[model samples]
Target: MCVAHASGAPPSASTKAKSRPCPESPTPSSLRPMTRPAPPRSGSWTARPPCAAVLRSSATTQCKNLGPCTSGCAQGAKSSTDITYWPVALRAGVELRTRCRVREITVNADGMADGVWYYDEDGEEHHQRAEVVVLACNGVGTPRILLNSTSPEFPDSLANSSGLVGKNLMFHPVGFVQGLFEDRLDSHMGPQGCCMLSNEFYETDPERDFVRGYMMQIVRGGVWPWSTAMLGARSGTIPWGPGHHEAFARRFDHTANIGILCEDLPEEHNTVTLDPELVDSDGIPAPKITYTLSENSRAMLEHGVARAKEAMLAAGAIEVTGGGPARQAGWHLLGTARMGDDPETSVVNSWGRSHDVKNLFIVDGSIFVTSGGVNPTSTIQALALYIADTMKKNLANLFD
Candidate 1:
């Protein structure tokens, strides 16, 4: 319950570092606090320095605007782990390695994780021996590593005695409700996805067709103009060819959007497996994600869309588009290496330590037993901080 941030991590470096007073203290809770999305950076052609540059403002390193920051934030405005924890770790003398792709974790003779085989950016192989192994490779990447770490002692892959390493994959299926309005809403002004949200339908209703519900988040305009125009026309949201300009003009400023982040139950069939046909440049097998929505999820989506359309209409939308079952929407991948009490049914235990390997700990969304309708980053970071504290309590005998 320590995750009380608007997002997963604290915003300002001073607050995170504790030199300055934190607005709130950690509290015990099961649910995470919800907040509006990032500030709108739409229609922006300007760039700012990342936090690192500010740290050394009088010195070298200036931020360059690579693009829209849709792929990644070159300006370092993003509170990514590299900028946050990595810098602190380096200052503490922790050796930080960049661009190294891990192949698999190597186990010792007694089936204990002790080392890793990874390839550097130059394709040079390196074996890193460690007292503990923490798998923080999101759901998909972690499972791929485990599945590929096939050894004679643990033939089914390391720490995969449960045969559930890559199973029970859960993704928060998403569907958008776009509303075209009469007046300009300036929907694209702020960072695209960061707007007010509603949790009115966040809980499950037994009376309904699904066991769980979803969150309806306000999605303002942050998409590129061309994407909005072309895809809108292609998807029939706008007119085509000559008339498309007129349609785009009408919808551009006068649009309201909402995204539904649905809770997905863990299904063993939704899996991540190494593709025999696909491999990375280092010749390591790449993971192939195979997921499909269950009937319950589909029913939930139908209900959600209906509710969204109703809301759009109430908000005076001239036209509403985008609904039904979400396709190609796998935003929050989770439950692949789920945590549980039993070693036979789960890959990791309650604290995200591997059931088959005592030294291996998973501190990511992969340990999520359930995918909440809300954003998981805050919860994920909270869990990590909790686990780190737990490990600290046992640092004297960590390898045991």
Candidate 2:
């Protein structure tokens, strides 16, 4: 993997030498570690590599650093699949359907997935048939579709013989530590997050309270004037009325933040189920998620937050305020339909093919056996490519 600076400028000459085109086929050694340059800030930091698809190529555009990346990139340089892959797929004769919501996967008389039943924007339901069906929905949506695909042959649900369709839902439990800096850092000028990352505590140590560990990412603090005021008021740092403007000025661009991505282990109890009373506009049952941070996760968050505070203080932060197991930080959904060797213990096989329904393939986070300490997007994409290649190589025996 190549680590690029978060400044969003073209990579330096040294950085370009270390960078290479990512492999077309996934391999065990596909992500070899490469050395990174020193971070721009004062505290000790490690440059985190951007997404796997973000190779510095002539065809690719550099980031404009407009910030607010989470809200969608305005510059079209984010390299989302829609921007990077859809054009090629469209040229390859792939049909691009729009404004259609898949309701369920339909099975054939031979107990194989045939296609999907979806609803269009007009609230009209239709069935699209196929020789094989591939599901690329994320963890939640994948399991919800499978669980709702009940039939006479597979009375419980299609590819759900293991009875683990919606079980073991996992999320990246996160914590945040914001440091108040005395000087204006202009921290929000570049990519919102992904400024720098530290994996100093990523591996598990028996001495620590947690079995697994977490990653600390240096994030640019929010700098918008209105957002600053709202955050300050919510945290009681800036009160309403007389001194609000003064407090806002003090915090507008003078803060730094570190976000912790805790590795959440699989627990069968954390799950996604269909809500009995809730439904979408087409009357399809909606998915309801149930999750709680495990004791191990809470411990990891506590440790990560403490370490982040120390880093901030060492970097000359005036005040360090931190908390753990953030309620709203369940961003990466994974492990609901996990893969394994045993048919009774897993929903899919190592190749991402459903054990019970050979014609059904899953290419998403749902097939993750374990949720790692970092983001899963790159790994998910690699798995999709791997699965596609496997299907191509074994076309004759694909469903056997």
Q: Give the per-residue lDDT digits (tens) of candidate 2, residues 1-400.
A: 1222322223422366343433221211111111112222333355543432353444455565555566656566666776668766887999988999999998878888888899998989999998889998899999989888898878878788898988889999998888887777766565566456676677889999888787787776764667778878888998999998888888877887888998888999999989999998888899999987889998898888888887777666788786877777777889999999899999999899999999999999998877988777767866877789889999999988
Q: Single out the weakest 10-residue window by summed lDDT for candidate 1.
A: 27-36
User: How close is every model to the real structure, measured as TM-score?
Assistant: 0.80, 0.86
Mark the regions of model 2 whose C-alpha exceeds 4 Å error after superposition. Answer: 1-44, 51-59
Tens digits of per-residue lDDT for model 1, 1-400: 2243423233422245333322232211100111212122111111112222223322323333223335555556444565556777787899878899999999888889889999998999999999899999998999999999988778878788888998989988888878776666545443344244565666778789888788776666425677678767668877777787777787675666777878888899999999999998999999998988889888888888887777666666778788856676776779999889999888887777888889999999988888888668768877887788888998888656
- Looking at candidate 2, the ten consecutive residues that score lowest on lDDT are 27-36
Candidate 2 structure lDDT: 0.75
Count of steric clashes across candidates, in order: 9, 0
Residue runs of model 1 more than 4 Å from their true location after superposition: 5-78
RMSD of 1: 7.8
